[model samples]
Target: MFLTGEMLIGQQSVTGSSAPISAINPATGERLEPVYLGGSEAEVERAATLAWQAFDAFRETTLSQRAEFLNAIAIEIEALGDVLVERIIAETGLPRARVEGERARTCMQLRLFAEVVSRGDWLDVRVEPALPDRQPLPRLDMRLRQIPLGPVAVFGASNFPLAFSVAGGDTASALASGCPVIVKAHSSHPGTSELVGRAVQKAAAQCSMPEGVFSVLFGSGREVGAKLVAHKFIKAVGFTGSFSGGTALMNIAQARKEPIPVYAEMSSSNPVFLLQGALSTRSAALAETFVTTLNNCAGQFCTSPGLLIAEKGALLSSFVESASAFMNESSTNTMLTPGIYEAYEKGLSLLNDNPNVRRLAQAKESDLPNQCRGSLFSVGAKDFIQDESLHEEVFGSAAIIVECDNFEEMVLVAESLEGQLTATIQADESDLGVAKHLMPTLERKAGRLLVNGWPPGLEVNHATVHGGPFPATSDSRTTSVGSAAITRFLRPVCYQSVPDMLLPDALQQSNPLMLKRLYNGDWEV
Candidate 1:
């Protein structure tokens, strides 16, 4: 239960010989104890070797066994209790309630994947019997099932240290798909990562899993991550960070002798479209909720409404005035790290200095270290459409409103956006026609679309999408959260005319696993 600055490699605790790294408490600007040293290519090799060794056995585990292993991870994480909560709060400077909620979400994701594994649905098995006496050139018996890609390399994110770090969605889904995982812990919260890493280590041991089923490594820079991605043993990757960081990993993965898939969730502005009818009836109320969503968690959420589009009118002016009043009264919030705070300040300055952009509201100043002050800015639709810099994400509690001359201009503004994680439409019954007209563009621009709702928090469930196109993530066909995430680590293999005795349990003639499969082009319930 004690924190020791070490890299976890196949159940062994080894200290890194590279540069040392320590966490800083963003709230008070004080550095915490237990400095974690960085790992090099040597450490990456050890973890990669062990993971490759464990892949075959781990991937062939029975459905019940894999489900039990996932459940055990949840149990171990919950067993950490208040120690986990406190460490998370100190390392990230997030509020106590937020930390606790994130812990619950982490465990919830594990259990959810556990259920996903037990159902045997992700295998997508199929079988076709041999037609010995039939038609032209009799068909050979065939059976197909999804198989796990080898070892996976996962990179953590600065925000959501618990829910999106050590044992977050990426790790859970990969393990569920029967892939071994090697996590590259985020530098901002090494102590917290170490604590949760130990929990996973204990779970693997208790469940009698392979030694390298899970491991965590620390590094200050790109050396460890880059080396891991380039290693021949790593088959796929899962990453969550900035656009530059994600693209860097993608480049490494693609440049390898044998390229691998990298699912990296990078950037998103999560634009919100305010329709004319909705603004007219509830401008004051919409302003209140908009400011609330804009400043939630200091607006660090990837789903935060960073862009708002509306037609210029008396109603839109009223909405802006009310939102500015609320913004001035908004409280300053502590960010996760000093570097993140600095980047946020720089983003605000760019908007403040731009001639095409007009600053509408600025929150009260704060003397506290690493705090975020809410900001609101506005620009004409033409400027927003012409300037690509205006489309870039700020990564903090700053939002830009686009004032359009008419509905046509609003539609044009929507078309000008890049790929996003989510696109929200605030509309009423009267605005249904406009909403319908804009649906096709929004569908292509984002992965998830919302109506009459804000985009701040995400629900972790069976039918949730936490991914998008292009810069939002490297791959749009897959999601980084929910049950479908298991598909990312899986690829199908078909066995033709294989001996019945040698067939896998799921694809055998007797249907031993009781999975719902496609048989002879018909459903086998």
Candidate 2:
């Protein structure tokens, strides 16, 4: 299918003539095809109305039916082929291989959620038998089961246009949980979003699902996204972007007539500490690996290791020199968008102008437009602790190595750090004492901890936590990836003294869904 600029609302193709948005190639500063228009407040109202109409039927769908619907979406996305991949690269300025890889990942996660839906573990059912002979008053029969919240609003991410965008984790988990979704397409990649949004619409029709099961709107966050969050029909929101944007949405949700949850993945430096033993033995290799991860996708990843903590010594100095050489010599890479490129420049200038910050390595400027050359800088632990600007994320191919006086000072630095999505400790068996000492602090500091490995590689599994406290994410009580994400769009309902005929299948006496449940004090048979 060809890429259309029209927004996908229910079963209709909507063209918003009021306001328009278009994609631009960051590498060449050229505007691509498909000038997408923004939907009006009336359009947002229509989508939410349809979703409310479909909510009851969609939420009551059988596990097998919902699982099949999710699987159909994955198949439809796979069929998009080169049409989807090319548009993503054109809009994002990323390499073809990376775009292709992201496409496959998007499909893989959708299908994975299909399997999870079939498994039915997210329902979290509980049963308690009725009692008639207990004390003066008999205990009543009781049962509890999880149900889908109302429609969900997702804000597509500019970084991972595929994996974290239109049909990414948030949408997949929300759909799998039987909640209708309305995605606010990122202005940076409207064409790509339009294509994926159509694929989802096609799959919903093929599966004979409700008409308003999914929708995608094109516009800036201010006009379209803010309207969607404030709409009373929307029960929850999911976002992945900057701290200011996330916090803004969070405040909007909280200030609503009826407050709803907003799960936003925001800023994280993902600090990495170089232990004495590991730096002494493998400083060269560690430096190389650090530079490689820091420059991946122009360092657009949320898990990029932006901070390095190490003690002041010749070993640490060698690591810095090796890392600087590796970074400065690396080839120039195209960033996601021109705005991000300009922001990266401003961030670098902020650090450069700071008196306490020292520039260690500066990559040669590239001849290409919007090309981000790698850079490395250094600062003392005391300076870093005192200056709040040092803790802010640069969002590109840049990192700062903080050299401390000793392990105690490094511990103090770690304690004073902000929340992170990931924190790593590169150490050997000989450095177990310091590693143990830092484990507790690191555990409290980040959602995920690593040893002797880079942090950019995120796994889509049950145990993975692609979230953190405070600025890392809005709600640390839940996650935005993995099977756990389904819970974000779900709420519990308890039935008291209800007849089997009246109870939902998941909570009925027959155990019709065959789902695992907690009965009294025992697990389901």
Candidate 3:
């Protein structure tokens, strides 16, 4: 069933008693369906009231029960994997392999959070008792525990519909944290969103969750999103999108009478610095890797290295020539959505028309349906540094080769970068000597640091930081792609002078939660 723009309350899609808007499929450039626009003042209040009702019981539910619900959700998502993949391919024009991988990632993310909940230890609480005889004097027992922050608003991302949309990390993590979620479906892939939404609803029913514990709202208007962010019931927000859109929501959240946290993973122009020694020794290998990095997934990844700073010389010229040739020979590709396609063209046009920029190679249009070719551009390091627009992200199979005169010029270019999700250093033995100087500078400019490697394959582990500063993400301290994602859904709450019986299971000495924790300066389980 096509999911219309209606407020999902309990297990039903209740159309708001008002006008609505249509959600389109970008691949076909067709109107798939219309979603009911949410009603004004009274409707917002009603939605909030339902969420509050659900929260009271949902928050109090046992962790084991919550785990069952989350696990069920994961299973349901897996069962519908094929259906989800097909819809995603049709709506977003993503290759089948790519869609399958995203589906796996989505299911993995859900199961990961479920395991985190099943262990019941992510909420690990710590306690320290004070002795009256001690020199520090008698003190009350201090305890720490993580608690949910009420209802959350999740903005669906257009790029990775399954992994970042309804039933995605935001919804799974929030639900795992005992917080209800309201997802604003991305217009680009609403059909895929609805399929996943149905799976979530199925899981909620099987696990007997509260009626309003999760709601999926659909609309195509800016006002719909503006109202959702401004709603008093939304205690927090999760966004993954462009800088302008993310920042706009943040401003609205801040303007609230009582401000809420808005976790927005914005845009990034991840940079790569190729040292002279490395470029001189491994020009061909570096060129191939650079081509793969820039053209991977049509360069739609957030960590795509948009800028390349190489020392000015014959080595640099060779690297540029090989990379340009590789991109030209690569197949033309379809974008995730038409909106993205338009943006990519516009960004490319802007860079191409700039007087300082020069086209290195261009792809010829192919007969393949829905496939658009891409081109490569370059400019001198001095010119790149002087032009602010050169730094913007051009989301497609494109790369900018910046030729630098020497190590000093390379460092200057590195220093000029805005916050990024990652920055890679292609260095050899001799380059390592200089790397000591460049690594620190690069670390300050990005969240993740790579050496002689690519940044596209994100590992969802404890050490991975999928977020960065400013344009890379609104907050560098949190990540949205790994187990660390739990941090986004949790806030610490201290239990002061409460009796052991009154203390949360997470904090009790008996260790009922059985989660990994630090106790008396040692790991405990």
Off by over 4 Å in 3: 1-7, 16-44, 366-372, 515-525
Give the better candidate number (1 or 3) by lDDT: 1
**Whole-model Cα lDDT of every candidate shown, in order:** 0.93, 0.90, 0.79
Judging by lDDT, tell me the better candidate of 2 and 3. Answer: 2
Write model 3 residue lDDT over 1-525, tens digit each, in one string. Answer: 455656665577766664455545544666655454644545555556677779868987888889889888888878885767877887787888988888888888888887777776667666665445766667666778888888888989987898888888888888888998888778777667778888888889999999888877766656667787888888889998888899999999999998998989888878888887898888988888778767666788888788888887888888888888877787777777767878888888898789889988866676644454667788999888888899888877777888888888888898888889999988899888888888878888888999989888787665778888778888888888777777787888887777889986778778776666666556776
TM-score of each: 0.99, 0.99, 0.93
After superposition, which runs of candidate 1 have C-alpha atoms over 4 Å from their true positions?
none
* lDDT string, candidate 1, 1-525, tens digits: 799999899899999999999999999988988999999999999999999999999999998888898888889999999988888888888999988888889999999999999999899999999999878789999999999999999998899897788899999999999999999999999989999999899989988999998999999989999999999999999999999999999999999999999999999999999999999899999999999988887888888899999999899999999999999999998899999999999999999999999999988889999999999999999999999998999988899999999999988998989999999999989999989999999999998899988876789899999888888889999899888999999999999999989999999999998999999999897
Scored against the true structure, residue 145 in model 3 reaches a CA lDDT of 80
Q: Model 2, poorest ten-residue lDDT window?
A: 217-226
Backbone clash total, candidate 1: 0
Error of 1 at 266 (Å): 0.5
